[model samples]
Target: MFNDISGKYDFLNHLLSFGIDKIWRNKLLGSITFASDSKVLDMATGTADVALQIAKEKGVEVTGADISDGMLDVGRVKVKTKKLEDLVQLVNGDAENIPYEKETFDIATVAFGVRNFQDLPQGLIELHRVLKADGQLRVLEFSKPKSSFVFWFFGLYFNRILPFVGKLVSKNNTAYRYLPVSVNAFPEGQDFCDYLRNAGFTEISFKPLTFGISTLYICKK
Candidate 1:
């Protein structure tokens, strides 16, 4: 499903979120505290947006790993276009089995990608395995709003307008339709934080972004 929509993934993403996605990504980058020479692993890195941003902001060497070669193809083009080939690399790999040695990365990140994992716990464990001791891990994901009105509005938009527009633009009805269903079914807030703890990450904290439409989770190994 993801491979099929790779071409339109970034396009519909920016469109469906009204460009707020970029702002959110920037915020996630800002929250990251890393050394200049940090080696970062971006898992499930669709189009390498976060990985590129990390390199641009922190001058870190970034490796982006994703299961979809089609998505990595798009990300590679962007890296070339930005002249970041020296700093950023994209790999076709799964989150549940990162193709790297243990304790390799200084930082790990996933942007709106964890919910798509076939086995979330296995993916989290893999992330933990590759991260250096005391390394930082940041994750961005969709969440339900706390306010009733906002929740209702977001629900309507996601359940109705988003799927319609996503299908029209991406030409993948099932994929877009699955978006809302997945978000709705995925655990959020403290429930998700507890999952992180179970995966062996400590100092877990989450911050709601953009009126609680999404959340940024920070954890430590």
Candidate 2:
């Protein structure tokens, strides 16, 4: 499913969000306390946007792991084009079964990716295992708005408008429709915090972004 739409993924993301996705990504970047020689593991790293951004901003090395070859192929082109090949590397791997060893990374991140995990708990645990002691995990995901009006408006756009635009642009039918279904099925806010807890994460903070159109989960291992 992902492979089929990989080419249009980045384009549709910016277009659908009206370029607000960069702000959300920046918010996640702000949560990190970058250091010299810091190693980052970006799980479910479609096209390596966060990884590439981190390397450009902090000059840190990032390993982006995802299951989609088509996505990685696009990412590699961008990496080489930007001449960030030295800092950013994308691999074919899964969140539930990461290729790296335990305690390998100083930080881990997933932007709008956790809910797509086949085994959410196992993915979280694997992320925890790869983080060094006291390492932080930053996550960005969609969430329901607290306000009734906003929730209704948000639902209307997500369930109706966004999917239409997505399919028209991406030329894939099921991919766009599946997005809202996955987001609706995902456990957000406190329920999601419980998953982090079960995965041995602490100091968790669930901060809503853009009136709860999205959320940022910051946690420590």
lDDT of 2 by residue, 148-187 (tens): 9999998999999999999998899999899999989999
Number of clashes recorded per candidate: 0, 0
Using all chains and alpha carbons, the TM-scores for the candidates as numbered come to 0.98, 0.99
Alpha-carbon local distance difference test for all models = 0.93, 0.94
Off by over 4 Å in 1: none
Residue 83 C-alpha lDDT in model 1:
92
Please give the lDDT score for candidate 1: 0.93
Position 132, candidate 2: lDDT = 97
lDDT of 2: 0.94
Which clashing pairs does model 2 show? none
